[model samples]
Each structure stands twice: as structure tokens, then as C-alpha cells.
Target: MTLNPNLRLRRAARIIVLDPEGRALMFRYDVPGRPPFWVTAGGECEPGESFDAAARRELLEETGIIADPGEEIARLTPEFITVEGEPVQADERFYLVRVSEARIDTSRHTALEQRLMTQHRWFTRAELADWPEAVFPESIVTMIEQQERAR
Candidate 1:
């Protein structure tokens, strides 16, 4: 495969957090000049951090819930622009994290997340597929279904 040397590679972890009632938690990112988009709770792995640990940490920072990242269910490599505007190829591992109830608190968000993330909501698979705003990964519905069904 031809490699793009200019692309910055990074390790990241994302969680598809499901509430007890089966809705997934999502955050709306309102970046300036761009349309709003929704994404699961996650972020880049800190230097030398493992995917699972990063998943747990990012979950707590983004949702204020401390829970085990249920399982490593899916993986994807997606190219996107970082919050800092740098182009990156993210080696992302997706985990399924189920909670007993739907809860969210953004007080602990990092400055970048706090500034770009304007709202949080719970959505069903159908909503995710048809939401007015775009969802990251673009294939989240199918990926979630495949992993969820395997459970």
C-alpha cells in the first residue's frame, strides 16, 4: 500500500456508550464555519497510553461516568482534521460501553471539547442513521449493529 508520509498518524479510542434503554450517547460538535456534527465520546490516546485506558479516561472526561469500556468491538481508520486543524489519520478502536442509566455531565471536558462541543443527547440507531447532522465514522449505524448483535 502506498503510504502518505505527510499524514499524521495517531492512536485513539472511542466508545459507543449505550444507556439502559438502548440509546447511544452522542455529542454535537459546533466548530466555527462548519456544520454541526455528532460523535461518540472519545479522544486521542495520551503519549504511551493504551487504547483501553484511553477509552476509560476519555469516557470519564467526556461523560463524567467511570465505567469499564465494555468490549473492543470495532476498529476503523479514518482521516480527518483535528481540532487544531492538522490533518490526521486516526487509528481508532471502538468499544461498547453499556450503562445502567442515561447520564451525562460535561463539566470535566477538556478545553477543546468544551469549546467545540455544544450539546449532548441520547439517540437510537434510527436517529443516528437519519439525524440532520452528520455523524462521524459515517458507518456508525452498521458498525454499532454488528457489534451489538454479536453481544
Candidate 2:
């Protein structure tokens, strides 16, 4: 995909939250005007908030899970156009997060305006690999593979 020069690139944080079972939390976001896609626990950086703080806040707000952010696992630039076909880009910072528990509460999420998240699931590395096309960016898949290999 071609990125438009006039469009600004934004920094976002993504958490690879893992439980004892080696399952990572993922969710399917159904965008009203775009194709559905799956994503890890994360969101855009809030003004004046640190990346780590934004990551934790997004994880809690989106999944209602409390976690302690761990070391930075990987960094990627995942580019995609918005639903309206406008050029967009995200400089995603991926972090490994250790959570004592997982919850699916959406009570505090206020950004469900344009996207409806249908289902949230915990996926193993193998399961994620079996996902259909374009479910996740290639860079993210590579990062996950590297992490798995290191384990």
C-alpha cells in the first residue's frame, strides 16, 4: 500500500498479553465500512501520556484486564488505509505484558463508535498462524514467530 505524504503517521502501542497457558489475547474488530480484522490489546497514544501508560490504559479499557507491561518485544510500522480509503499509518510499539488474569468486560470502553468488536479470544501461536489472510500484519506475525522461537 502506498502511503500518502500529506497524511500523518501516528504512534500506537500494542500489547502481546500472555497468560500461563501461552495464549495471547486477541479481538476481532468489525469496522462498519471496512473489512473485519483482528488485533492485539492496544490503542493510539493519548496526549501527554507515555506510551507505556497508553498501552496499559488501552488494554484495561478494551479488555478490562490488568497487566504489568514487560520489556519491549518488537517494533513495527503497520500501514493501512482507513475505512474511507484515506492513507493512514501506525508506528506500532509491541510490548510483552504479563497479566494475572483475563477479562472480557467492555464496560469502560468509549471508542466503540465506528467498530464493533464481535468476539474476543485467547489464541496460541499455532492458532494465530492458522488465521485467514490479512487478519494481522506480516510484521506482527514475524515478531510473534521470533518470540516463539526464543521461548
Candidate 3:
């Protein structure tokens, strides 16, 4: 994707939240004018907030999961247009968070997210590899494998 010249630079704290069975939790976005895509849980950091803090906050806000966001597993600098139609240069950090359950609550999502983010699903490694739709931070399967190896 072409980076918008006027794009705002932002920092994001995302999570590769996995269930005990190794499936990662993902949300699907059905943007009005774009093909649907999946994304891990996360959002931009609040001003002066640390990435670690943002990870924890975003996990709770987006999925209603109150858990410690484990070590930072990977990082990416991706430029994209936000659901709000704004362009952003996202400095993203992916953290690892393991959970025993896959239940999620979207009640706390922002208005834009509530409308455009349609549903959530738990994707196995195979599905992540060929889900047909784009999945952000595309290195997820690698990250999950590495996390499993380290455990």
C-alpha cells in the first residue's frame, strides 16, 4: 500500500492472543468499500503511554480480557488507511497473551469499530495461512510457532 504523504505517525500495541489450543483470536472488519480483512487485537497508544501499558489496555478494551500482556514477540511498521478513512504510519508491536478461553466482549469498542468490525473468530495456524482475506502483521504463524517453541 502507498503511504499517504500526510499520514500521521502512530504507535500501536497489538497482541497475538492465543487459546490453549494454539488458535489465535482475530476480528474481521467489513469496511463499506473494501474487502473484509482480519486483524489481531490492538489499537494506537494514548499519548505519553508506554507500549506495554497500551497492550494491556487494548486487550481489555477490545476483548474484555483482563490479563498481563506477555513479552513483545514481534514488531512491524505498516502504513495503511484507518477504518475512519485517515492514513497512518503504524509503529506496531505484537505481544503474546495466552488465554484458556476464547470468549470476547466487543462492548467497549469505539463507535467506528462497533460498526465496521463485524465478528470475531479463532483461527488455527492452517486457517491463518490461507484464510483468503488479509491478516495484518502477516507473520503471526511464525510468531506463534516461536512462542510455542520457547515455552
lDDT of 2 at 11: 72
Number of backbone-clashing residue pairs for each candidate, in the order shown: 0, 0, 0
TM-scores, all models, native as reference: 0.93, 0.80, 0.93
lDDT of 2 by residue, 45-112 (tens): 98777778888888788777777666668777767775446566767778877566655677776656
Considering every candidate listed, which one attains the maximal TM-score? 1
Model 1 ranges off by over 4 Å: 1-3
Task: Report the alpha-carbon TM-score of model 1 versus the true structure.
Answer: 0.93
Model 1, span 1-151: residue lDDT tens: 3335679888899999889878889999998878888999999999999999999999999999999996688788877888677888888999888898897888998788879998999999899889888898688888878976787
Shift in Å, residue 40, candidate 2: 0.4
What's the lDDT for all of these models? 0.87, 0.72, 0.90
Q: Give the least accurate 10-residue stretch of model 3, judged by summed lDDT.
A: 1-10
Weakest ten-residue segment in model 1 by summed lDDT:
1-10
TM-score of 3: 0.93
Residue 144 displacement in candidate 1 (angstroms): 2.1
lDDT order of candidates, top first: 3, 1, 2
lDDT score of residue 143 within candidate 1? 81
Count clashing residue pairs in model 3: 0
In candidate 3, the residue pairs with backbone N, CA or C atoms under 3 Å apart (3 or more residues apart, or in different chains) clash, namely none
